[model samples]
Target: MLRHEFQPGRLVAGLVFAAAGTVYAGDAAGLWDTPWFVIVPLVVGGLCLAGATATVTRGIRRRSGKKRLGRSTLDG
Candidate 1:
């Protein structure tokens, strides 16, 4: 049995990395120019930082018994 766990941080990171790989592959295949290889780390790092902040903030709010505006607290 597989446990259902929803982690948007990991998903965002994975998607960013996948996009970087796709860009590299496309460049290698003589596709459109993606000369901004440096963007990969910048984007990934930004996403990681944002994700971490969000996760921590959410955890803190949940622990404090506070509710966010849109996120449902329904446990189904």
Candidate 2:
């Protein structure tokens, strides 16, 4: 059986979500201080931005390659 490859970007996003949830849980448990609470939102927002950028970049690259191939075939 072929194993699926692991994606670091996806892993990072998952970890960020987990961490944010843990932080929220800690706050509910009265273990998290207000000063440290800002980190959770920042981490989650950063992960979202990174993931979106990665996806858009990959899509643009793929489309550019396809267009290049089409243009080359047309010129030939």
Off by over 4 Å in 1: 49-76
Which has the greatest lDDT? Answer: 2
Q: lDDT tens digits, residues 1-65, model 2?
A: 99994465677677777777787788889995556668767696968876986687678778999
| lDDT tens digits, residue span 1-76, model 1 | 9998566666777777777778778988998777877666757685876599669867976776655433465642
lDDT minimum window of 10 residues, candidate 1:
67-76
TM-score of 1: 0.55
lDDT of 1: 0.72
Error of 1 at 23 (Å): 0.7
All candidates' lDDT scores? 0.72, 0.77
Error of 2 at 19 (Å): 17
lDDT of candidate 2 at residue 63, scale 0 to 100: 99
